[model samples]
Target: MRWFMWAAVAGAVAAVVLAAVALMFAGGDPEPAGAGSAPAIPAATDAAVSEAAESQVTDAPSASPSSSPSVKPSPRPTLRPMDVIAGLHTTVRELVQDGQLKPDAGEDLTKRLKDAAEKLADGEVDKARDKLEEFGKKVAKLREENKLSSAGYQTLAAGLAQLAALLPSR
Candidate 1:
């Protein structure tokens, strides 16, 4: 009779230990004694394991920081007015080559950009600004006619506007 009682006590103790270990490993919240509720054990899903593995891989340190202060890259230098005009010319030529702009339209735009650059070089800022505005108007017309895609129109218009902004205000 005493051996039978001892066996029952041992079995009960083993069950309690197993439950505690499960709760610890399964990340479950253990219910308080006499709470009359069991701990909610999360099911070990493949997705959960995969997410944990991925997080560990991503969180692994790739490099150690140096004791020296970090240096930042320098800012890009601002473009000159002539450089902007030249860039606009190149952009127009490339668009024509890419079949995005018709040859005739490209030539007209290039001429305007070249003239503007020359005017800028001669200190005729207002004239250069006018030519850039003209180029923008032409781009808008092409967009309206559906000859230029919205993207193309936007690229050309933005370049023209930037060039104009670089010139002195009237």
Candidate 2:
């Protein structure tokens, strides 16, 4: 009878220890918002993204005829400086034609864009990028002075951002 009582106590202690161990292995609650950190991604969403990426990897055709298939990296085409400058000019022209920007501002921006393109042609890439950044600032000031609509500002900003992406980072 005494041994039976001891066995019962040991079983209860073991159960409590197991429960504590499980809690320790489980992660704590997620951090609250406004904690000055990135928002936490849900576990399910992360798993889905991982699965999608893995499927893409498996779908790619094998490159070589080895015992195990190897992933081949596809080559991405490089953008030339002039090509990017031209794209900016095209976007600006559309904005002018749409009457979303003042004629004077458009003309001034056009001239500055042409100068930047010329700099790129001359192989002065850094100078060209500097000119582009300067032009972006000018456009922002003009948007404020003209009281451009939100749509107009977004259009101009998008063009500037696209051009900026093509330039090499300082």
Candidate 3:
């Protein structure tokens, strides 16, 4: 037990010394990540005056003290419910054209999806989501009735699930 304690103390001291040395070598402070970022520290004291010759690509040319890029690519846009509905409409059309889905069923599904998209656009999110759920049930029924290929049904069902997921919850 005594030997174990001595070994642990020695290890802790060594770790502390190593960490201090690493921090010193890494520079006094590291830059923080976020919107309000400061200009990068110059590699050398004299390098700051020759920034134009450095050939470094900055986010943008700024006249301000802050060198951080102001405009980040609009935080990756998420699919809206209407967008999902449009995709479903296209999928239904494709399946119909490929003869994997019945023309009548495809037409009906397209109409339902169009209505759902319209409803969502009109601020009827819950109603649109309900319509989408019903549409999914209809797709399942097509599988049960053997009116659609398994693969086609799976694709359609997945699209419906995705669209439903995009809808805002009640």
Candidate 4:
């Protein structure tokens, strides 16, 4: 009947409208359900009706830019020599607590870090640099003796290197 064809067309139009609205809310382009292919309309439907439905779906407005929030990266904080020494101290203490480093070794390393910090605070750049070099040597020896894990050795060595770079050249 003529009424049945009109109803089918109306239903298809409503479905395309709903899909477009859903895509807008999802923050994406309102592409048709099956791009480059005929829509799933009844075989009795006319080509004109299919073409109209496809145009309605494709011509729908795209998602708004304001739908998604923009993000900006925060600036990285600069680390001072004393800060590196403090981090090294914490790393050494953790290693000792985890049984990765013997208490004696940890205590010695911690003392060296403390001394380096104090020397740095007193404007004794050379002395602080010497302490950092000593720490690096001790770390290497421990690694060679199998007393320090490779991870532990790497952590301490990197911290020492960073601290040395922060200090003034001899």
Candidate 5:
């Protein structure tokens, strides 16, 4: 009986250790939210991003893809770059609207992202992709700089990856 109990405890410990390992493999920034003595969102940037985010919840979900198979419409693009930007924009909007931004020099980087996404949705796939790539790079840079918040860069990277996958094989 004691052996069985020890086995169960060992199993639980193994499970916990495995979960921790998985989380580490999943990749996350070391800093926690509100960890760095700095606010994630700055007031000025938040306001600008919020204004651009007005169209975040787009009335039109999918823009028609080009006829070329390379640009063929995805029957279901789980996380299009535009969609990702739109949702993120909305979050920025709410953050600013809720006065969550700090007086710090941080600027609303969201508007620039939204504009880039609009270029994508407007049938400019190449441009969109370029912009998306740029956005991903920016996100990565911000993360490395410890300027990213709560998996924001990770989500951005995921969105870019989704868009890349949905594209027809070049």
Candidate 6:
């Protein structure tokens, strides 16, 4: 948890730095009052500098920050364990629907897992409560029955952990 907090702080700092650098490179023709901003000149020598900096902002709009090449969109979160679970759920569902996976308890279990993954992905915490609990039990049973490696179960458990991270405690 401490490590996560530190990482968050580091990420925020890095984002600020990158935003600053990107703004500097943009030279602020019409970016927001925050990013890509340059301190207003005294207005006396403005004409000369404006002309000098004019070429830099040609490709960028004089109003929209999105036009600025240096302005980056907000970063998307990387796919974590829950994301992996969603991908696996989608894959397994497709396979089962196509009759690739034999119909039986495995199909039912995979469907339940898929629903739980979907619920987790959708941030439907309450809706997924029972499903998540059942999925854990199912995964545990699979680990025991298949004699799967600790790592294999660890990966599945890691997905559950990611789900937990996304949810509010019951």
lDDT of each: 0.68, 0.66, 0.68, 0.71, 0.54, 0.57
- Minimal lDDT window, size 10, model 2: 23-32
C-alpha lDDT (0 to 100) for residue 20 of candidate 2? 37
Instruction: State the weakest 10-residue window (summed lDDT) of model 1.
Output: 2-11
- Local error of candidate 6 at residue 49 (angstroms): 39
Residue pairs with backbone overlap in model 1? none
For candidate 6, list the clashing residue pairs, or say none: none
Q: Write the per-residue lDDT of candidate 2 for residues 55-169, one digit (tens) a residue.
A: 8886657888668676565543555657756766775675566666677777888898998988888888899888888888888888788734345565556556656665777
Give the per-residue lDDT digits (tens) of candidate 1, residues 37-130: 7678788899999999888886557898669987665654655778767767776776676666788888888888888778878888888788
lDDT, candidate 3, at 44: 60
Of candidates 6 and 5, the better by TM-score: 5
Worst 10 residues of 6 by lDDT: 94-103
> What are the per-residue Cα lDDT tens digits for candidate 5 across 65-158?
7786554443432435565566556544433343332213124456556767788678787776676667667666666765554334444444
Instruction: Tell me each candidate's TM-score.
Output: 0.55, 0.52, 0.55, 0.56, 0.41, 0.40
Top model number, lDDT: 4
**lDDT of candidate 6 over 24-78, digit per residue (tens):** 4465634445666677757658778888787676665576556546757665444
State the RMSD for candidate 5. Answer: 25.8
For model 3, the superposed segments whose C-alpha errors exceed 4 Å read 1-74
Candidate 6 lDDT score relative to the true structure: 0.57
| Best-to-worst ranking by lDDT | 4, 1, 3, 2, 6, 5
- TM-score result, candidate 5: 0.41
Query: For candidate 6, what is the TM-score?
Result: 0.40
* lDDT at residue 50 of model 4 (Cα atoms): 83
Q: What stretches of model 4 exceed 4 Å from their correct place?
A: 1-75
